[model samples]
Target: MAVASVTYLTRLAGYIALRNRTLSPRIVEVMEAAPGCVLISVIAPHFVSDRPADLAALAITLFAATRLPLLATVVIGVCAAGLP
Candidate 1:
């Protein structure tokens, strides 16, 4: 219960803080890129560890991301990761 309250209050505080503010276009563009940046941060270590499967998967996913839908990219990535 205490954890939940803290989580809720923190989120609420952020919402209240941003609710009245108007952000610039550049900030909004950066915000849009934030998820991909975070995802790369999380995945970079795995890529740097010299794992062939992960490298293959990332390559396949990158290619699919450019040519296919999100769901297809994910499916191809998972399949690539399972490759031996």
Candidate 2:
């Protein structure tokens, strides 16, 4: 339909634009870290907030993220956030 055709053309245009381009190693590294940087930007306020429970949850989530797999980290983070 109309939506599908628009989506396809948009993707095709992007592919054509970048088909012959190569990113530098430094740029690639920065791009790889961008998601984590954005995540921290979003969460930093809550982590530094005045709420004790939120602080505790942030600490637990940070520790879990460093030591556990993605699924486990998310599970522990959720549980920590829900703790009294």
Candidate 3:
């Protein structure tokens, strides 16, 4: 739990720092969207049996949250759960 918290904090800090860098608006938008996407992907069904899939999902979730739309994020999360 401690390690997980630390990792989360570190990722958040990095996210903030990246946001502060003032990239193009398009880039920023994408960045914002990435986390949501990744989160959805992470929780996707079939995520239980395959470690590789889990990692991929986690990466996607992180990526989507960085720039993905909030609505899309929620939808993806919901959809992921339903996936076989």
Candidate 4:
């Protein structure tokens, strides 16, 4: 597809451009943080909305995330969201 080709070319261009350069530590740190930032971006909409259910689930998940493992936090979020 055209989209896929464009995406591949775009990534290839970045790779070629950076091929001879050493990434700075700051850039590495930002790259490491990218996934978590993306995750927050995805979940952030739920936090900004006025829905009680989403707010409660986000609160429960945030609390559990601090005290529990990733699986437990996800389970708690799912359970909280499923509550009627």
User: What C-alpha RMSD separates each model from the true structure?
Assistant: 5.8, 7.2, 8.8, 5.5
Q: Residue by residue across 29-51, what tens digits does model 1's lDDT show? A: 76556556656665678767687
Kindly give the stretch of ten consecutive residues in candidate 4 with the minimal lDDT sum.
Answer: 2-11
The true-versus-predicted C-alpha distance at residue 41 of model 3, in Å, is: 1.8
Tens digit per residue, CA lDDT, model 3, 1-84: 664566566558768888657688888687667656654564465445566655555556556667888787666655654455
lDDT of each: 0.74, 0.78, 0.62, 0.79
RMSD of 2: 7.2
Q: Candidate 2, which segments miss by more than 4 Å at Cα?
A: 1-20
Q: Weakest 10 consecutive residues, lDDT, candidate 3?
A: 38-47
Residue-level lDDT of model 4, residues 1-84, one tens digit each, is 664566556556666777788999987676556556656766789989798988988899999999999999999998999997
TM per candidate comes to: 0.61, 0.64, 0.36, 0.65
Candidate maximizing lDDT:
4
- List ranges where model 1 is wrong by over 4 Å: 1-16
What would the TM-score be for candidate 2 when compared with the true structure? Answer: 0.64
